[model samples]
Target: MTLRIRHLRMRAKTPAGPYGADIRFASGLNVIWADNTKGKSTCMQGMLYALGLERMLSPRREVPLPHAMTSFLKNDDETQLNVLESTVSLEIENGAKQVITVHRSIKNALVDNRLISVDFGPTLTDKTVRTERRNFFVVDGGAAKREDGFHHFLEQFLGWQLPLVRRYEGSDCKLYLETIFPLFWVEHDVPPKFHPAAS
Candidate 1:
């Protein structure tokens, strides 16, 4: 599955930067070009929200960060951000392209932040079927549930018990990914790989 975001607006009542992040994702590749403390996390948070991740690790927040940052650009509407939108486009394997825009609103309190995503419009044949799954299992988010899938990180951090079914098969089990909705996969903060020579 692939996704693209364009012309997204995540405004606030302060002066920062983008209303939202402009990004795109293709065959296991994603990239974002943003400056320092421009609520880059906010736009990423929007994607996390759009992708439907129940738990999110907000970088840091005050004044509904997105809205607060947006307020800087907004002149006409001093008290509120005029528009906050995130647009996404996808190309299915069958060669069908679809676009979905989420018009968001952050007209609320800082302690009680809010993000409202509106399905702007799209060019697709089927409207009923959900093209994308929302259950976002991210690495940096938080804890995980056993039902979501056998999270090895949970096992590492906490502990794991083998199921009776697996035990019966004489399997001393260790599993990695559960739902495949990897939030960590997007992470590229890694040192270079290497192999040791035979001593």
Candidate 2:
């Protein structure tokens, strides 16, 4: 299925003030460009984080965002402001024209990071969509196959029936999203490798 990201937003509450970014994409190709350390990578990471795909970047359960998101952010005056809480939302559209908005808390006192809320409409783009909300869990066992699992819900939304693959122990397990995503998404932080041709 063709899945496209329609919008992405990252918000962080800080003592100095609120800091964040909101980006909207069109139907076709979209590119983000900015100067160094201007949150270009942060936006990309936020999208993955909101969709519970942060594990594509690492095997650790830790938040993949920079300190600006987890701890503090610097203002235009170069003063560091403590971040109280942070959240990210991603709006996406499937090939069938179905839209959904995913909300996740990256760092918050009240909300658990493992909980992901899904709105069954383009709530981020349209205010009157009357979207239905559902919650799912991630990072726990059976998250990829369980009914209440975020990845399982995501696979259904994308119309994907992942096949089981043989593991090292000769046991079969469904191909996890962590394994499939790397084939489609190229990370900005990892450098490319070059190998010489055999003589």
Candidate 3:
């Protein structure tokens, strides 16, 4: 399925104007370029924010949530309102063209309800392969653990659960990576054209 998000603010919401919180997303391959501080990454962030990734948020002045460190910088309260409103619109499913829109202020738990179903646990098991590749695993959240990447440790507390996801396809696969931080995060800087065929 293809996804798209629009109208999210990092520092502040879009000004009331002709194009409030304007953004466009393209399927297949999409690349954006611009000068520094021109909201290039911020635009991408808007989509991530709408997708419900907590740590990806830029942070408001105060109001903290679990694992979220609130900004405590001293500021003139009466003259400063740092609250930011963001809108996210996305299309899910390959060609279904279903669009959903969301608008809200920043919060500590900055993730979507459906996306929040990912879980990570150390004792998870798999269907086959003898369970020897004890890579710290992630399932759905709320029902499991957070803090991804088990860090390649000795057999003391590390063990394999085998990927419940056999081939890493569909929503089950996406949930697995989202909870444990997708492998793509490490390859974010790699150009797609230069990708190699390796495990």
Candidate with top lDDT is 2
Q: Each prediction's Cα lDDT score?
A: 0.37, 0.90, 0.33
Q: What is the lDDT of candidate 1?
A: 0.37
TM-score, cand. 1:
0.36
What's model 3's overall lDDT? Answer: 0.33
Residue lDDT tens for model 1, 27-77: 444465455554556656554443333234333433223443333344434
Error of 3 at 63 (Å): 9.7
Cα shift from native, residue 193, model 1 (Å)? 18
- Sorted on TM-score, best first, the list reads 2, 3, 1
TM-scores, one per candidate: 0.36, 0.92, 0.38
Candidate 3, which ten residues in sequence have the lowest lDDT sum?
Answer: 149-158
The alpha-carbon root-mean-square deviation between model 1 and the true structure, to one decimal in Å, is 12.2
Count of steric clashes across candidates, in order: 10, 0, 11
Where model 2 places Cα greater than 4 Å from the true spot, the runs are: 187-199
Greater-TM-score candidate between 2 and 3: 2
The deviation in Å at residue 171 for candidate 1 is: 24
The sequence of per-residue lDDT tens digits that candidate 3 reaches over residues 1-199 is: 2233322323333222112234444455556665654456545554444344434343342222211112211122433333333333322222234332333234334643223221122111212322222123212333233343221111112232325454535444212323454433331333346677899
